[model samples]
Target: MEILQSAAALQAQTEKWRREGQRIGLVPTMGALHDGHLRLVQAAAAENDVVVVSIFVNPTQFNNPDDFRLYPRLPEADAALLGPAGCTALFLPSVEEMYPEQSKLRFDFGSLEQVMEGAHRPGHFNGVATVVSKLFHLSRPHRAYFGQKDLQQVAIIRQLVADLSFDLELITFPTVREADGLAMSSRNRRLSVEARKKAPQLYKALQLGVRLLEENRPVASVKNEVLQFLAMEEAITLEYFEIADARTLQTVEELTQPQEVALCIAAWLAEVRLIDNLLISAKSL
Candidate 1:
């Protein structure tokens, strides 16, 4: 696979591919190269003639300095994996290469970002939107791949594309999981052995919430049920247990019959914060 390090190099190579009329796909990732990320690359490979995977651990996205400092970077190993995943190019840019200086500009998605993940992570999506916007502009791919592990991120990116009118498709892949069913994430590495063992409970709790909703339980009771279960777990501290409209993400009171509800939960297993979610059928209520 070709390695493009600088912005100019990425632009030049992408331009060459564009001149040749080759379809290009881009997978933006903060490296450490897990099955989750490779999944996105493989999906991109199937649909596009060429795929470029950008591996830059963006500093702006981290709310905690230690977390940013502790983030993993393994470019050589990542590049080797990309080659097998049908990636044509891998962009390994330095922090300065991405942003020589910190950017003063910021973007706001109104209420779409000011609750749940956004509520807890101040200025997090701004960093995400900014860097993603930059990557989309740099690679100019026909499509970009993102995993659904970060559901709110998908929501935010979908809004960004529509509001800014970017000429690219955003395809979200299903959340990759461990054998025991913890959602795959770059941060999963940060969990201690004890924490990892308890982590799958997040997904298990989500499953319970799904069951309650499917059984036609009242929205209030279902939410309370999930919250109670989450609270019962000594290791898992609940952040938000919400039942909201599928589209607007606004919290709903009643099921109101056949409706789509998003059951989202965020919690902390000690310092390792994790989010898991499920879509529920309104008929259960």
Candidate 2:
């Protein structure tokens, strides 16, 4: 696979592809290859004639400077995995390449940016939107693939696409997990062995939420059960657990007959912060 490290190089290749009428797919990710990310690449490759995977750990998205500093970067290993995973090209850009000037731009997603991850990490989504916009412009893919693990991120990006009128399909795949059910993530590498074992509890708690919602329990009760479940785990501290509307992401008080809702949770285990969510449909609820 050809590795395009600069925006000009990516645009030149993709522009040539577009002229030849080749269908293109873009999978945007932060470098630190894991099965989860490879899954995105595979899915993108399956549907499009040409696939471009952008690997750049965006500094703007990190709320904590330390977290940014600690984020993983394994370019060689990442490229190795992508070569065999059907990736046609890799868009590996640098911070300076992406942000040539000191960018003061910010994007607001209204209520979508007001809760859960957004509430905790100020300017996180703005940074996400900014970089994603840059990637979308640079790659100019026919479609973009993302995982369901970042439910809120998917939501935010969906909004960004619509508001900006980007002519591309947005595809979301299921969250890839380990055999033990821990959601695969770049940050998972930093987890202590014991913390890794405890990590699955987040998914387990999400499972409890799904069951409670299926039984038509009150939304608050379902949220409380998941919160209490996380609370009982000494090693994992609950950040926030909310049963929010799938579209608006506003926390709900009661089920009110099972509309589309998501059970989103975030927690801290040792130095790793993990987030997971389960989507509940009206038929299931």
Candidate 3:
């Protein structure tokens, strides 16, 4: 796989691909590759003639300095994994390459930025938008792939694509999980042995919430039970557990009608922050 590090080099390569009439797919990621990430590349490779995976640990998106510093970086290992996954190119840009100067521009999604991940991490989505917009422009791919594990980020990017008039299809795959049901994450590497053992509880809690909701239980009651369920796990510190409209991400209090619902959760397993979600259609309601 070709590793293109600078923006100019990447754009030139993509332009050449475009001139050749080859369809391109872009998978943007930070460099700690796992099976979940490789699955995205494989999926992209199956559909597009060329798959470019960008591995840049975007500094602006991190609200906590410590989290930024502690975030995993394994470029060599990532490249080794991506090679067999059919990745055509790896856009591994440095911080300096991505941002030569401080950016003055910021993007706001209004209501989309008002809850859950947005509320907990102020200025987070703006930074995500800034970098994502840059990637969308630089790669100029016909399609982009992201995991449903980041349901909110997908929603924000969908809005970014629409509002900015970017010409590309946004594709999302279901959240990848371990045999024990823990959603696979790069941060899972940072978990201590004991903390790792308790991490699956997050998915279990979400599963319980889904069962209760499917049984026609009240939303408020389901929320309370899920909260109480997580509280029993001393190792996990729950940040937020929300059942929101799948598309708008607005938290719902009652299931008055049939609609897609996203059960989202974010919590701390030791110092590593983890987030996961489950999407279900409330047709039974």
Candidate 4:
């Protein structure tokens, strides 16, 4: 697999592929490769003639300076895994390369940025939208792959594509998980043994919430039950647990007309903050 470090080089190569009538796929990631990330690459490889994986820990996306500092970055290790996953090229750009000049523009995603991750991290989604918009333009792929673990980000990107009228398809793969059900993440590496054991409880709580919803329980009650479930687990501290419309992402009090919805949660297990979600059709209840 080829490793590219500049937008010009990546665009040049992809242009060649386009001339040859080859479909290009792009997977944007923040460099700590885990099974979940590889799963995205695997899906891209299955559908596209060329798969480009971009690994740049976007500095603009982090609201907390310390979290930015602590974010894991192992390009060599990430490349080692991608080499075997059939990736065609790795767009490994520097911060300056990505943000040639300090960007003064900010994206207003309307209500989409008013809740969940946006509420907690002020300019976080703006940074995500900016960097992702850059990657989409740079790679110019026919399709892009994202994981469902980041449910909110997936919604934002979908809107980004529609609003910008990007001609590529956005594909979302299911969240890859551990044998015991914990969602796989780069941050999972920082969890201590005990926190690791308690980590699966996050998924378990989501599962319980799903069951409650399926059983015709009220949306508000289901949320409380999930919160209580997590509270009982002493190792986990609830940050936010929301049951909202999957598309609009607005918290719903009642499952009135069987809309598509997601149960999303963010919590702290020790110093490691984990997020997970489950999507379901409330009509199926």
The numbered model that scores best in lDDT is 3
For model 1, what is the C-alpha lDDT against the true structure? Answer: 0.87
C-alpha RMSD of candidate 4: 1.0
Model 2 C-alpha lDDT versus the unseen true structure: 0.90
Tell me, by TM-score, which candidate is best: 3
Residue-wise C-alpha lDDT for candidate 4, range 193-213, written one tens digit per residue: 999989999999999999999
Better of 1 and 2 by TM-score: 2
Between candidates 3 and 4, the one scoring higher on TM-score is 3
lDDT, residue 178, model 4: 93
- Evaluate residue 241 in candidate 1 and report its C-alpha lDDT on the 0 to 100 scale: 82
- lDDT for position 136 in model 1: 87
Residue lDDT tens for model 1, 1-285: 989899999998998999999999999999998998998999999999999999999889888888788887788888889999989999999999999888998899888887788889898999999899989888999999998777788889999999999999999888898999899887788899998999998888888878877786787888787788777779888889888876667788877766877878888888878887777667655
lDDT (CA) per prediction: 0.87, 0.90, 0.94, 0.91
User: What shift in Å separates residue 59 of candidate 2 from its native position after superposition?
Assistant: 0.5
Clashes of 2: 0
Model 1 alpha-carbon drift over 4 Å, by segment: 281-285
Considering only N, C-alpha and C atoms within 3 Å, which residue pairs clash in candidate 2? none
